[model samples]
Target: MKFTSGPITRPLKMGAYLKVSYNEKRSQVISWEKVNKNDVPTKALAKLQ
Candidate 1:
């Protein structure tokens, strides 16, 4: 998978595999998943948020 600085500030044209987790009553992204495009959901491609 590829890496970008800011998804909220600056979005990319490609898809990414995110490693999301919940801890301390908060949600955070640990790292990128680095998976294939097929592994991602169709809705995620439509909306990157």
Candidate 2:
């Protein structure tokens, strides 16, 4: 999924280069992946500035 450093201002597409994944466990199985970002969308970026 698309990733960003802040809340999404618009819909994002999957398989974005910004997407990240991590591992987690509860009992014996690894949980879902977590996504993060180092940058944000240009529209949102402009707004933030």
Candidate 3:
């Protein structure tokens, strides 16, 4: 998985995997993970993992 900070300037490709964690107190994302050209997790599959 690839991780990044700050905002993205372009659109993500199909099957891109992303995981994000937001910090409500700070009003921002505290953590992020992304895997380009990889399979994105389905709702059910995400829940299982």
Candidate 4:
């Protein structure tokens, strides 16, 4: 990692997903799922800080 401290064992994957549903007042997380990394959109990925 460019700015991470210590040794990195494994690479990070963009597979974690949270399904959200909105209501009249506020939004809530419905469920959490692990989606395929390839299924994720490139624009959604963030650059390392």
TM-score of each: 0.38, 0.22, 0.41, 0.36
Q: What's the true lDDT of residue 15 in model 2?
A: 39
Best candidate, TM-score: 3
Task: Give stretches of model 3 more than 4 Å off.
Answer: 1-8, 35-49
lDDT value, residue 9 of candidate 4: 46
Q: Check candidate 2 and list the clashing pairs.
A: none
Off by over 4 Å in 2: 1-38
Q: Would you list the rank order by TM-score, best first?
A: 3, 1, 4, 2
Writing each residue's lDDT as its tens digit, candidate 2 over 1-49 gives 3333444555555533232344555333233233443455667547645
Least well predicted 10-residue stretch by lDDT in candidate 2: 26-35
Q: Tens-digit lDDT track for model 3 on 1-49?
A: 3434546555556555567788999977787678543455577457746
Report the number of the highest-lDDT candidate: 3
RMSD of 1: 6.7
In each prediction, how many residue pairs overlap at the backbone (N, C-alpha, C within less than 3 A)?
0, 0, 1, 0
Off by over 4 Å in 1: 1-16, 30-32
Over 1-49, each residue of candidate 4 has an lDDT whose tens digit, in order, gives 2221135544445544433244645554343345654665666545411
Q: Per-residue lDDT for 39 in model 2? A: 56
| Alpha-carbon deviation at 12 in model 1, angstroms | 11
